[model samples]
Target chain A: MLSTKEIKQSIRSISSIKQITRAMEMVAASRLKKVESRVLASRAYTERMQQVLSHLASSIPSERSHPLFTQKESVPVIKIVLITADKGLCGAYNNNIIQTTAKFIKENTGNTIKLIHIGKKGNLYFSKGGYTIEKYYPENVEKFGYNQVKTLASQLIDGYEAGEFGQLHIFFTKFKTTMQYSPTSIRLLPIEKDAIKTKVIAKGEYIFEPSAEQIIEHLFPKYIETQIYQCILESLTSEYAARRVAMIAATENAGEMIDELTRSYNKARQETITKELLEVISGAEALIKG
Target chain B: MAKTFKIEVITPEKVVYDDTVQSITAEGTEGSFGVLADHASMIAELQTGILTISDVNNKTVRFALDGGFVEILANNVIVLTDTCTKEGEVDVEKAMAEKASAEKALLKVGSGVEKEKAKAALKRANTLLKLANK
Candidate 1:
């Protein structure tokens, strides 16, 4: 059993920890609100873009393919873009994404793998594991804007055009709800026709400005850029959500610890007082008898 | 009141414009074109230029659009672009600086891809300058 002094010390430390965790929870909640709104606003643009792409895909003949949509079977190297949070207080958020990416790499042993890390945590883990890291955009996850997405998209497209890799895939956490997020992998390159194709075929025949091919050529890059932007936004939102939940749990645990410690402290103090009282009564009885 | 159709100018960050307008005139890749109410459903690739919109009251609003696509379906016109700035929102000093830097980059870049990118930047800067001056 701990003495009252030791128990009191633990209680003080735990209450301070609770204070910090409570503050963190509030911060995460506010940040989550901002990111959630951003994610919702960007959904409209991505949905509209998907609709236009599907319309264009249906109009163009299957035989005619754009450079972005061309599959290169000869190249054996696979490029994986892994997105994770820079900071790691969030429970299992970064670990889950890194594990998913590692599993992907392990499953595809036949082909050589190259990684492009979007966050510091992923880059650090992969680099320590002796994997080949082609690019590392550390700290960009926190402050990614349209220009950053554009530059990243252009780099990926240029690398693909140069035959640096056969296929390009991105791994990110999809934000389903504040309480739920899952690691999702999307094949970005070679423009999966079936994935973008909509069930509701566009109503009427449409006119293209220069040609269907030319419009698709322009639209494909924009499509890729938009997809990357949307994924980053979703991942950011999920990170905030995860952090909020983790902090809330931490705060609750701290509260429980503080309560238990306070009880033990009181019990130890009461035991000491009872023992002193018994000694005092015995001393009085001994004196009286003497 | 004139017959108006819905137009929404959207970027990745947010929806820039969403309202019913009488007509919209924008610069397509090929040439400048105007779309009135009940126009045919068409998709046009836009270049960096001024986008003019006329309201029901005949008041015109101009925006500098930096390269995007415009889709017309039913009575809805969707302008999906990288960036859109209204006439008064264009910053003159920033546009001038961008124009100068883009010109410098265009002169320095030798590869085809770099040249194309620099050209696009120059065009965007020019459009913004024009809008700001107007």
Candidate 2:
């Protein structure tokens, strides 16, 4: 049984913790709203880009191949771009992505695996584990813009062209809903042949300005850039959603603890008062008898 | 009333414009071109320049576009760009400041990708200023 003073102290501490978590929950909710809009807007752009690229891919003769579509039989190394959150208070968000990457690396034991980390948490975990970190962008995840994504896309394209790695995979959390996000990995380089193949063939012959080859050549890099940008936006949205949920849970737990502590504190105070009253009454009776 | 076609100007951030327009004139990498309703299906690479759009009411709306691509099919025109700012949306002083900074950067950077980027930035700034002043 805790003394009333101890219980009271605990209730005060817990109530303060509840206030902090409540503040965190509200902050996460507002950030989530802002990021959600960005994610939805970018989604429209990505969908249009995919539609155009697929149309081009299907229309172009098979013999006309782009360097980006070249798939190697086997290569010595594989690169993984792992995206995680910068901060850790977000439930299992970072852990899930890290685990997914680890599983991928484990499964690809025959090839040398290197990592490119986008967020600090991934970088910190992988760097300490003796993995070869190809690159790490230390920029804050919340501030990510098109420029940063462009630089990253160009680097990845250059490395792929230079044959630095046979295959490039990106691991990110796909935002399905506010309550659900799952870590997903997709092969980014040497884009799979079937991925861009469209079911609907061209209804008629189309004119290509500056040549079809030039247009396809220009569109492929933009395709990669848009894909990467969409992934980053989705991951950021998921991060905020996860943080909000985690903070809400923390706040609720704190509330429960305060409630329990207050109950115990009241019980302890009542017990002490009853004991003191009994002592006083018994002493008075003894005096009366004497 | 002029026959109109649907035109959508989209950037990565959002859809800037989506409405039925009488016609549109855009700068293609090959050269400037105009499209009316029932234009042939075509795909053209775009350059940094002013995009002139005439809506159903024959009202002209201009946008300063950073480099991207334009696709036309049937009666629909899709203009995709990295950034698109309407004439009314362009900030003249900011465009001037950007132009000055881009010129400085163009002078400082040697021959390579950096120079190309600075040149593009300068071109975009110039286009924005051109549209705004017009």
Candidate 3:
């Protein structure tokens, strides 16, 4: 028979684990709140930027003048920038992106595709799967800032302008709601036609300051950078939300385990007491008979 | 009639200024331009300079902008900037320090991307300092 001491030890270990998971859940919840506020605040800037870009794209004549607007004739090479979290234990947060990238590579068998990894998880997964990693962002994902995104944007712009890659795509988790995030792929290069459509206001006749061409030369690059920055912000918010949900689930599971262990521990103690009482009664009965 | 139009100055951080205004003067990439109520629709690239607005109360509010763009509609003008600070909100000593450091970096770096970045930083710092002093 198992001793009561062993049962007590199991109960103690389970309770300690429950405490740790509860603490982690609280931490994730607080971080999620901060990121959610930031995402909400940045939405205004992104919406205004989109409006301005669409206005320029629709109003201006000769849209093919800017290099960003023009597309190459045939697709030669493709670049995919995959974003994942550095840390694990966030449920399927990193797994979803990794699997999506794997599927993408599997489908595009003949294309010359190069991978650009933003977080360590994606890099570790793809590198093992025998994919060519063009670059891996060295900085920790938690410490991301606008300045880092700007530098990366500049590099991408330079490469796109130089015709290094015929097509560029970015894979990230789009934050739909606090409880839901979906993995999405968006084309980043050559500026998609529908993305510049303005739904807010009617098209109006406008004057360009230097010229439409000159203004576009400046606006297009900024527009690209803003899009990248927004995606990063959204991904960060989603990561926290995912982590919070995962931790909550883990904490609940730990609670259930602790409950089960406590019940078993109590049952073992009761059985031990009953056996000792019977033995004492028998011993007294034998002495009286003698 | 108050004879006012709406203007919203937004950055990545937040909406710095949003109000009905009488008039506004902004430094465009080509030159300085002023907008009044019912001005013709236009899109202009902004430089690192001051954006002066005359509010509905005829009180002039000035903002220092760090190189963005201005969009003018019939009744609304929206300014999209990387960094926008109110004249009163700026700290001159801090801006002066940033300017000095940027200038030093520019001089130290012979020629590269860092030099260009430092030059741009110096320009933005100077704009902030000027707006604060004014």
Candidate 4:
């Protein structure tokens, strides 16, 4: 029952909203393309790395010397790198990560904990609350490459090697599909012996060129770096997918509103025209009677 | 001739190369070594240098290896490392800058082990640059 003026104004506002959403959707789509390609390209590297590591673990009879491969105690202190988007309007993307991470952290509070925060949103919320954030990286997740990730990876690996932490955790929203994203926390460090897929190529007759200790000591940090890079890729892909979906939904909703408003505006316009027409006819009829 | 095997060069970001190569020439910790079709089981302590692989066409594909290890066994060679770039992909200016910075760090820090690491980094960057640009 809205007046024509009111209906027109509503339609104008809805159209503006739709325009903004459509713009946002285009931007998200561009970012999604890059991150998704990176993930796809790196999957081959990940598989081959797994193959090499499995081969080494099975061939070598002794334990790994690097701190990352060692699992100590019944309960190990875990360091978690939580990646969340900076802005809002992504629809439960941040909420999902925060909830899952909070639960995990609270339960593991009895053990030592450290957090690596990637986005401003998570840093602000966790810092405001009582969570102790060990490090915060404010870099643009969209432009991530191997060099930056290696630096961070080296820092963590160095810390672990220095006996700073026992375990590593990574939390992020996983991009399942365009319509679905699930916040997941995964163990990132300490390539467990049982978890290895590739078996050692040479068992007893293997010869370590310079020395066994030196070769393993070198490959450990690289392994850490590769793992972290994969996580960053996943998190970025999830962000884009989430944002794109959110924008699309908004645009569709705006379209529905526009349809409703157009109908209302038409009804109001017809009523106004009919009223004016009837008034003229009545006035003419009155004039004739007079 | 022996059957061809896969040689995959994997870095942290992505796979640099994955093709069936005839041989691998890499700088091992002890010395530079080449792996043919029937190589012995060897774990190489990788230093920073140029890694060259001979394709089936006998053409050489060179990759600048930063610091990591190379494992040659069963003819399946895996070069795992922190940084890797092909000859066509290397940035010479950047590598020179890295070498200079590492040298500067070495000069400032006199700690024996760290200085050695810095020295190694400089050598790696310089050698990779030389091999890549050549």
Candidate 5:
């Protein structure tokens, strides 16, 4: 049973917290809206890119001929690119993504795993716990430009081609909406060719300006870089959505706490006043009897 | 009767322009080339430059297409590349800035191939700015 003063103090502190959370929630929501618009605008480009890639893959006879798809003669250690948000308070968004990564690492067992963190949160957690990060690209979160992502993609693909990494997997949180997010990990190495994919055929066949093999070596790297850039965009958008939902919930919880404390304060005040009134009545009655 | 074929500027991102055009002047690897309707089935590697698509009215709409493959099949031009901008949508200031950077890169390059790429970037940026301002 807290005294009225204590209850009132608790209410004041809770109200202050409520204000901060409410402001955070609004900011997150606005950012989420902007990100969603960007995603929508880019979605059109993404579809077209896929078509172009499909056309290129089908036109070229040998995908393995490209170094991006070709594996080294000897199998070596594997690496993974793990992307997580820098800030917390977004419900279980960060936790879920990290857990998925943990499960994957556990299941693989024999593979040598390394992290390439895109966000501060992922870098902090993975490094603080003694995980070796092969590389981290936090610039993707602050200002996402295609060039930066393309550079990273080239480094990884070229490294893979040079036998630095045997296999690669990238992980991030996929944004569905303000209340929904899913962690996604996908394998992007070794572009395999299905007969249907290969046989789709180019409508008009022309001689390659240089050679068919040369065009592919250049195009394949660009494709991978664009794919990774898209992943970063999706992850950042999801982070904002998660933050907005988490802050909104926090604000509501604060409101509930304020209400509960007000009730407790009122009850305590009433009890104190009743005791004082009873004492006054007894004193008057004692005086009347004398 | 003159034959006009459809010039569909389909990018990996979206179909930017799809219409019946008179001809398309594109930068090809061997040199510059023009595409008219009913051209034989062929593939051409495009350099960064201004791709002009002329409508039936003979009005030319220019687009700055980055590096990509151009597929001409049955009168359609499918362009797959990293960046694209229509003349009306281009930011002249940004294009000028990009052009300046590319020019700077070319001045400091070590190889002929690197110089060519930088020159192509500058040319593309300049093309966009010119068309947008015009």
Candidate 6:
């Protein structure tokens, strides 16, 4: 049996761990609130942009094809954009993305797939793998800014225009609710007609400012950029939520562990005291008999 | 006495302006255009310039927008811009400094992509300076 002193040391260590987990839980909760609100606020702007894009897509006939809208005939190389969190302790947030990318690569063996990592976790995970990593964005999920988004978008646009890749897809975890998140894969290029279906077609009388062709060439890239930025924001929010939930569970588990350890420690101490009392009584009895 | 349309200007960060305005004068790529209520449903690509909105009460609000798209649909105006700042938000000293730097860059760059980028920066800086001074 372990001594009372040893048990006391173990309990003390567990208590400190519990304290750390509790603090982390609180931090994640507060950060999640701020990130969630930011994601919610940007919803309106994204919706409006999608609406305009859908309208434009419906108005323009399919025969007149823009570079962003036209799909190549041959089997084309695919670029997969992986978004993950910078830090760990988020309970499978990064693992899900990495594993998903791995599974996607496994299934699409025939096609040439290049990985574009957004967060540190993804870059770290994919860098060792045999798959070709095209680019890794250095910005952390929490520090994502408009300029970064613009730069990423422009690079992708230029690459697609230069025929670097035939298709592009972004993989991220969609924040569905506080407790649930799902890995979602969205196609970013080629702007398929069905992908942008208009809700209420603009009466066929909508005018384009500098003509339809120029607007399509100009506007579609911006739409894609906005979509990508929204995905990043959503992914960040989900990461915080996942971390908060995971930390809460961890803290509670630690509390339970501490309780169990304290009970055992108290029992060990009581047993030691009882043994000493018995020994002292025997010694007193022996002296009286002599 | 004047018809009003709902106008909302949004950036990636937040919604900068949302209100009922009598008319909006924005600088499009082609040229300057004034949009009133019940204007035909259309989309105009905006340039780096002042976006003037006249409220129903005849009060004018000017915002410096650094390139975006404007969509007019059923009397609702939604402006999606990269950078947006009102007259009250702009810092004159900072804008002047930016304008000077952008002008210098424009002069230093030779012909081609860098020059085009520098020119665009200069235009955006000029727009900010105009709004700050106003």
| Top-lDDT structure, candidate number | 1
Question: Among these predicted structures, which one has the highest TM-score?
Answer: 3
- Ranked by TM-score, the better of candidates 2 and 6 is 2
**Model 3 CAPRI quality:** medium
**Model 5, stretches more than 4 Å misplaced?**
A71-76, A128-131, A137-140, A144-147, A192-199, A202-210, B1-15, B18-25, B32-44, B54-60, B71-77, B88-118, B125-134
Stretches of candidate 3 above 4 Å error?
A103-110, A195-205, B2-4, B98-126
lDDT of 4 by residue, B71-91 (tens): 676777888776887887777
> How many pairs of residues collide in each model?
0, 0, 0, 4, 4, 0
* lDDT measured at residue A157 in model 2 versus the true structure, 0 to 100: 88
Model 6: what TM-score for its first chain?
0.92
lDDT of 3 by residue, A99-212 (tens): 987898888877888998888899999888578899998677768677887788888888888888878888888887979999888777866667543443355568889788
Q: Write the per-residue lDDT of candidate 3 for residues B1-134, one digit (tens) a residue.
A: 56789999999889899999999999998889989998888999999889999998899999999989999876789999988889889988889999999999987996788998999899899989888878
Taking the tens digit of each residue's C-alpha lDDT, what string does model 1 give over B49-87?
A: 999999888889999998899988777889998789998
Candidate 6 segments whose C-alpha is farther than 4 A from its true place? A26-37, A98-110, A123-151, A162-164, A176-180, A192-199, A287-290, B1-3, B104-118, B132-134
* Best candidate, DockQ: 3
Off by over 4 Å in 1: A73-76, A106-110, A124-132, A143-148, A195-205, B1-6, B19-22, B37-41, B54-61, B73-76, B87-134
What proportion of the real contacts between chains A and B does each prediction keep?
0.60, 0.63, 0.82, 0.65, 0.40, 0.61
Instruction: List the global CA lDDT of all models.
Output: 0.87, 0.87, 0.84, 0.78, 0.75, 0.84
User: Tens digit of lDDT per residue, candidate 2, span A195-254?
Assistant: 543433455656888888899778888988889888888999999999999999999999
Q: B1-134 in candidate 2: lDDT tens per residue?
A: 77889988999889999999999999999889999998887888998898999998888999999988988877878888989998888899999999999999988997799899899889989999899889
How do the residues A173-268 of candidate 6 rate in per-residue lDDT, one tens digit apiece? Answer: 888888998888877786545644344454445688877788777777778778888889889989989998998999899889889888898899
Candidate 3 structure, TM-score to reference? 0.87
Instruction: List the pairs of residues colliding in candidate 1.
Output: none
User: What TM-score, over all chains together, does every model reach?
Assistant: 0.82, 0.87, 0.87, 0.81, 0.81, 0.86
TM-score of chain B of each: 0.95, 0.94, 0.92, 0.86, 0.77, 0.94
lDDT of 1 at A97: 93
Residue range with the least summed lDDT across 10 consecutive positions in model 5 chain B: B6-15
Superpose all Cα atoms of candidate 5 onto the true structure and report the RMSD in Å to 1 decimal: 4.2
Task: Give the C-alpha lDDT of model 1.
Answer: 0.87
